[model samples]
Target: MDLPRSFTIRESSHRILNPFTDEKLATLGRALHLAPGTRMLDLACGKGEMLCTWAAAHRVTGTGVDISSDFIGAASARAAALGVADQVTFLHDDAASHAATDPVDVASCIGATWIGGGVAGTVELLRRSLRPGGTMLVGEPYWRREPPDQAAVEGSMATSKDEFRSLPALIEQFGELGVDVVEMVLADQDSWDRYVAAQWLNIRRWLDRNPDDELAEQMRAELTTAPVRYARYQRDYLGWGVFVLMDR
Candidate 1:
């Protein structure tokens, strides 16, 4: 099983595969105060950046699972490049079915919670792999401001306004799930630009090399319009963050 070729093509150059920048990710890792030898299970771990980097910086060990073989290969290469190959492992498998063989110090489902159906279900799924008192990290988008209408929501890449809650409401959601929101690192417009705008360059470079590829036109169209759409709606109205949670 793998992500659609188009999706991987669009993000071919991405390391983190989310809105987070390298500096922000490092800051988050430092803030967590990860102890040496901490075991983590990261589901839908695109490119395995989080696991690989943390393994190097915090001296932790982790397993990352993702459906994309391409991403798994990239992740493995990253681990080796970072000289942390022994500290992290990447599996090309469906994250939804992945359960840690042993309880881990951190359980994470970042950016791709649909693997567990939604936020609540994803939390339940992560909990199955987490040790008591261990941390859970969830990366998600929240509405920075209420969308004025359906059009606004659609412009922000959401099907409906209900797709995301406001920032406060999202925090309340974690509370309702019996988890304490302990720490978070948010993405600002600049980071959002870095994430979204980089796709255009990747798509353009891919199109130049593989002009006859089946998905070229689709990528071309997206590259043409994505910047405007993202700046107009997503950059201003949508906010993303990685939140640290602990069982209450």
Candidate 2:
């Protein structure tokens, strides 16, 4: 009931596991005009940065569910540190099956659409937890440009180019689902670099301390090649953003 060991280790120091920076996250909260006590449900909520920060800044209260125990622990600690422990909660559970107990002002699943299979399914899953006129936040990757070939796709860690739609087509996807894309904030290449490059340093520091760990070899290989692969493909061809959606 957790993410792979490699993933947790690589992102051990990350508060926000995705490309969305703290500033971008704050901007998103402000853009939403969150009212005090706004109830939110964040699936795959990682370290619960959104809930904790929103609770502190916007006075929103929320629950975050993530399968990773390590992440859940960190999230709880974060809430406590922010002195918002009373406003938010984190549960270590499989988000795919964690049904919301109450309707919420917002339901979000960021960077983990696989919980319901894909973007459309994930959107429906979140929508089920929303109150009338409530919003859904979906963080997804889009193809910024057509990859030149298979190498580009593989380099971006995608099985195929079809895995992501272009930005315009992505909006159309929301249209197909009867939702309006009311707002969005995109991640630029610098943010992508910060998110991906930080992993190399984390792995390197861990390798320095635990040279004989079982995953060391895999981590070493990943660190060795990630920079080139990321700069060449992911930074240029992949675009990620969190879209704010509401029914039409």
Q: What is residue 153's positional error in candidate 2, in angstroms?
A: 0.5
Clashing pairs in 2: none
Q: What residue pairs clash in candidate 1, if any at all?
A: none
Q: Residue by residue across 1-248, what tens digits does model 1's lDDT show?
A: 77899878879999989999999999999999999999999999999999999999999999999999999999999999999999999999999998999999999998998999888999999999999999999999999999898877998999999999999999999999999999999998889899988988999999999999889888888888888888788888999999999999
The local distance difference test score of model 2 is: 0.93
* TM-score, per-candidate, Cα-based: 0.98, 0.99
State the RMSD for candidate 2. Answer: 0.7
Q: On residues 38-117, what C-alpha lDDT tens digit does candidate 2 reach at each position? A: 99999999999999999999999999999999999999999999999999999999999886888999999999999989
Clashes of 2: 0
lDDT of each: 0.93, 0.93
